[model samples]
Target: MSEPEIRLQAWETHIEEFGTQQYGLSFDTLIKAVGKGPRAAHKLARRLKKSGRAHVVRIDYGSPGPWRNSKNFDEPGAAPHGPLWMFADRQIAWGYLEFDPGEWHPKASTAAHLTAVTELRLALTGLDTDPQVWTSERLLRRRLKTESGLAGIHIHDAWFQDFADPDKVWAVEVELSRKFGDGRLTRSLSAALEAAERNDLCGVLYFVRGDGLRRAVEGAATRLAHQRNLDRLPNLEIHDLDATLARKGVR
Candidate 1:
């Protein structure tokens, strides 16, 4: 393929993946995905915006800023102050993307978590066994509403298949903070393990931040295993989120 065609193909993939995310992607995240320097990535983004294939929104505290005269594209030195990018509504209308443009806006508390999830997705691309399938939480929720078998099951942050093992699907959970209280964590874990055993998934992989949260998850897993008289609760795996991102040069 010609250089221009290759670049266009990359942009198409980037835009499609951006639609999968609940919230739009940050400029830094875009740069990482495109494998380009800041200035080049910004230029390409500007072209995409000009062509009406992408939408840009300035976000402050996870809310859209005033629409008028918002900095739609970021300059190279702007660093973290850049706006987020999403597929234009036309893309959805044309049936080219599954993401609902109306759901582009995210709550302030969830912005960071969503960004972390995106980072994890990008990091997976660098692995030896790259993802064969990646279904975002938004897409998974939509499926749950229509698929009878998915009802009452734990909805993971994302579901993916490793390229090396196409038949085995895995659940991904990005836990930035403690979300469950009381016995909720254990109950939730139990449900997930049971679902995995039912052939919904081959295993669950948790990318968690903080030592306390890791210990909590481990404790819950141990309790469940002991109660069930099993050596382990499925193929459960947990990793330090920050370290994993750093190793992949995604942080």
Candidate 2:
């Protein structure tokens, strides 16, 4: 392939890989994924848009409501803030088109979480042992329905296979807020750990926002450890999300 073709192919792959998982990709996220400066990334996005492979969703962060197409900003009360790229009909025909922006609008927090997860996935590329493949929660849930022997398993936010070792897989959970109010967190963690063991995952990696959340997870792990044999349990690692993102220049 020619140089330009190669670059375009990489952009398309990145868009399909990340967009299918998160429903859409924020402008900044795309820029990071493509490893290009803003101007270059903008050009690439324009080319994709022109080819009818993608469309831009204008988001009004202040309004915290449904996103509209970039061409629909003339409507009354419309306040465009940022652009989110989604697959167009041409691209959607390739499959993995489970999300429909018109039918289901994501809450502001939900959108932010999805962006964070995408950013984390991009940041992993900077590591020595990056992820070879990433499976989002949406895909995991879909698999549970069709794949046998996956019943009664709790799905994590995402799962990734190690680039260095194809057999090594990890379950990722991104927690931005406290979800342990009524023993719910413990139960969720227990299920995830059990699922890891059953699926032969290397371990569970929890990316939590605050120290309090990290401590809560640690407390839960300690309790689980007491209940089960520690030597036989899979590894559980709690990381500070802010620190991790900062280290990767994502913050």
Candidate 3:
């Protein structure tokens, strides 16, 4: 087989072994994984799709713009795009919950979704072991039914945790375009933070898109800590997306 095919096979094996079907790899992540340039990666992906080896999902997130095929490659106005790619055989073999590619709603925020995708990519590329990615749907299923009244404690866009010990995890909340200091955000995060503290997980990491968002998250975390009567906020860490990607060795 060729080098790109070999890389594709390796990525497939990783996904199968790691059971990351729920959060399918993104176009950028696929490019990085295959160590290929944009044109080559896009060509490989198109080939994979033709061979029934991959599935794709493209969304506009309530916007009216052509999808970005690659960093600099744009899909034509007449043609649609696919940003999320999943290996078909591996997803089924791993017994992961399946969903149709067409089910992606255009109303959701793509910026937030992209942030989660970046976090997943960073964990996959940077960590020694494959991380367990938990979306809000997964967390909702894990909510307690009994009397803490914590049914709606979903504060994270995605949760990244070591598969070996899930409690040693990061509750990743993405602040893409929203003001992190919003009251609703603070209230929801306060509950989740309390739960994280009680569970003694690694910590909650707020992935903000800008300095202003970072400051807002930090300030909110501080206020929550004081309100909860904590000496120090050990369960909160805020980072900018560029810093995270840089640390993960992604350009």
**TM per prediction:** 0.75, 0.73, 0.65
Across 30-94, the per-residue lDDT of candidate 3 in tens digits comes to 66655557666667666555555555556444445445444323344545544544444443433
**Top-TM-score candidate index:** 1
Instruction: Give the better candidate number (2 or 3) by TM-score.
Output: 2
Error of 2 at 154 (Å): 2.0
Which is the winner by lDDT between candidate 2 and candidate 3? Answer: 2
lDDT of 3: 0.54
Worst 10 residues of 1 by lDDT: 62-71
Clashes of 2: 0
Supply candidate 3's per-residue lDDT for 113: 64
User: Which candidate should be chosen as best, given lDDT against the real structure?
Assistant: 2
* Clashes per candidate, residues 3 or more apart or on different chains: 0, 0, 0
As for model 3, its CA RMSD to the true structure in angstroms is 6.3
